[model samples]
Target: MESNQTNRALIKATVIALSVAVVTLVLFILPAEYDIDPTGVGKKLGLTVFNQDGESPSAKTSTDGDQDTVVVTVPAGKGIEYKLSMMESQQVTYEWQTSNGELYVDLHGEPDGDNTGYFKSYTVATVESMKGSFVVPFNGSHGWYWKNNTDKDIDVQLIFSGEYIVEGLK
Candidate 1:
């Protein structure tokens, strides 16, 4: 009788442990790693950002050519992201300069429908100014993340001509 009771308890514990592990894998690991959100909780928590193949969704339709200039201030010891929504193969020429100090800059892109927090970095550097032309390789939001590490605020002037929709600061 005692052996039977012990066996039952051991089985119950094993089953419970397996159940918890499965729940964790489905609710957290799958969604965070593969963008598979069967229960939708991972997406709500902002964990899904990429697809199974680690690519963003299809490219959006291209827009007409446009030009814009924007000025923004980065607070001391702060960072900001500025983006442009562009279709695959869209081209843009851009120039950005800082008012007074150098900034840590990351130029990158993320796919349109990626829920699995994946991004491709095109450039990363600490600099005061940059001028370049880019042809987007995929349909996605492409732009820069600038971090001001100094004690004073830094103003950035960005001028660009492209076929894109400005996503501004984010």
Candidate 2:
């Protein structure tokens, strides 16, 4: 009876350990779901309309493209975390993918004494899937710069992986 009880206890321990291992691997494995410090993002990330969905994305779309600016308005909280993809050699080798569709980002103008203007600058990248592959140190670059290269205006839906901390507008 004692030996049977011992075996049962060992089985229970093994089961518990395996369960924990599986959960941890799922959470930390590469290409895992997005994760960020909720406290920081909750405090900072919010939505700002860069442009109405389904429009051409171009540098010209920005109202203040003339001036370069990094328009991060929201203050990041003390504890913020985001799940970023591990840097890969293949990712760096890609042609920066501007052909299919592009989001032209332009620099922003200087404001008060703050150097927010430095953050200004537009970026253009092709939009193949709605995903908009990003290499952000953050979960994602939420906002986008759009261009209406087409004669008629088109609606473009944009989705970013993580929270959008601030909104910058022209």
Candidate 3:
């Protein structure tokens, strides 16, 4: 009967819609937003490394006398970014210097769960060395973007003492 065919079509459409929704959640949203990858599809797609929720899986809070030093290498005409996780009101003292030449840098922070492209820039310029202290304004991630402008690779030595979480630089 025509009535029976209509009912079957409606049911089929509903099932298809639900299936697409679940696939989208599992393949994209879960991994990008929460680092959850039950089906491993997100990992295969390289989506699990990003956290749109403002919390990185590599992020950790530490209170002990923590100090770290890192050497970052940037190829010529290339750039890199690194960040430290901090709660509101946390502070850190930082210093960095380039072994070769002056480079462009931007020091900034992005608040947790911010989806409106909101960010705060503390410093932006070309500098060979810098030393300063930062006081976190919100629960978020703060760090630097460095660009190598010269025709040769550059080595940057960065040191920080703080009670925050930092990810390993690549």
Candidate 4:
């Protein structure tokens, strides 16, 4: 009879441990690491910054500022935008270059509250590479729009440092 009681207690303890592990994984681990927040808690906690490619849109914080390097792919005859969030008077220095050909590029900013389809263009041109620094005039998102007018896809490598948060590819 004592042996039977001992076996039952051990079995109960094992089951309890497994149950706690599963709950923790479903609630915290999956969302924080893999961006698989089934309960939407990870996004609310600002933890789901990684895309499918395992690249995070959030910048790496440093003593001087935030910095990041991102590679964006523009499909043939398509366009894409990479943006960063910044406050008024914040500054950033950036450089981007294409792998092969020139792209129609637009460096611009959109204000934080005006939603009348308005954006302020700082520069527009077709180029293979560009390097510049910008001080935002208002609290808003600032970045580049690259349009590839070719038959093959092109990759653009962008490196930037600033006091900003990356908004990712749009």
Candidate 5:
């Protein structure tokens, strides 16, 4: 009879522990750590903005500065250049559009010590507008070179955000 009572007590304790663990996982671990809040509790707590890696979507995680938005013009048959100094693994969001017509764009990056004109190109296209994000692969200046491909003057409006230095934008 004593053995039966002891077995029952142990079983009850085990059940309670498992229940607590499930509750904790559903309420806290799922939402705060993995951004997988099925119960909506994590969203209510303002934790859903974080990713599964515990990183917020708009977090400035490096030496980059605040968001920057700049608008410039590329005269007919003329071109312009702009870039941001960024470190490896840093992230930035970018969106740009031409007011009138199309612009030939070259999005590329050059390493800090590269003086041989060696650069990596992210994209080369004739686009009226674009929006995207990038994770910097190496410490470098990354940006765009736009040439007005239209007959009349064109205005290129660029809007950007993230961890980057806009000290040298032209």
Candidate 6:
């Protein structure tokens, strides 16, 4: 009789653990459903930037797909803005198509800002929270800029990442 009771208790605990794991998998591990059309061009660039000088270390990720989809997301309750910090010896650009199928080209910083002067152009993608999802039509090859203003050389990393759905792009 005691052996049967011990077996029952073990089985109950196992079942409870399995249930908790299943709930977590369904609620947190799955990505949101996107009804976005993956055609066109100029928006396959996935660029991510991070504030290496912050205390908590925050980051924002953006992707420009064929639909001019420049989607940016930050951590919950945080702001995000794409500021181009370029030096005198740098040239950067991002190409995308507008909703009307026109070429949308964007540049960063000023023509004369060395390493210390913050560039002039700014694209605000300030996301307010974690529960955010948005897309914009984009289709092109975005360029980049670099200028070594410091007396010593610097290894600036230009982060670029993305994937485009080519209609049988062979």
Mark the regions of model 1 whose C-alpha exceeds 4 Å error after superposition. 1-66
Which residue pairs show collisions in model 1? 48-115, 48-116, 49-114, 49-115, 49-116, 49-117, 50-115, 50-116
TM-score per candidate: 0.62, 0.26, 0.63, 0.66, 0.60, 0.26
Candidate 5, 28-145: lDDT as tens digits: 7887656788899988875543342242333343355456666777779978677778889888788999888889999888999999999988889998999998888899889999
Estimate the overall C-alpha local distance difference test score of candidate 6.
0.30
Residue 111 accuracy (lDDT) in model 4: 97
After superposition, which runs of candidate 5 have C-alpha atoms over 4 Å from their true positions?
1-66
- Score candidate 1 by TM-score against the native: 0.62
18-99 per-residue lDDT for model 6 (tens digits):
9999654444332111212133111222211232222221222234422222322222223233333222332333332212
lDDT of 4 by residue, 29-103 (tens): 787666688988777765554343455555433357656788888879988888888888888888999999999
lDDT of the candidates, in the order given? 0.83, 0.31, 0.81, 0.83, 0.78, 0.30
* Cα TM-score of candidate 3: 0.63
Candidates 3 and 4, the one with greater lDDT: 4
| lDDT tens digits by residue: candidate 1, 1-170 | 99999999999999999999999999988887667889999888755632323444323222534557778788799887878889898887899999999999999999999999999998899999999988889999999999999999999999888677766665
Worst 10 residues of 1 by lDDT: 52-61
lDDT score for residue 141 of model 6: 19
Backbone clash pairs in model 3 (N, Cα, C under 3 Å; residues 3+ apart or in different chains), count: 0
Clash-forming residue pairs, model 5 = none
TM-score of 4: 0.66
> Sort by lDDT, best first: what order?
4, 1, 3, 5, 2, 6
Q: Kindly report the root-mean-square deviation of model 6 from the true structure over all alpha carbons.
A: 18.7
TM-score pick, better of 3 and 5: 3
lDDT, candidate 3, at 114: 97
Write one digit per residue (lDDT tens) for candidate 3, span 68-103: 777777669988776888889888888999998999
| C-alpha positional error of residue 70 in candidate 1 after TM-score superposition, expressed in Å | 0.3
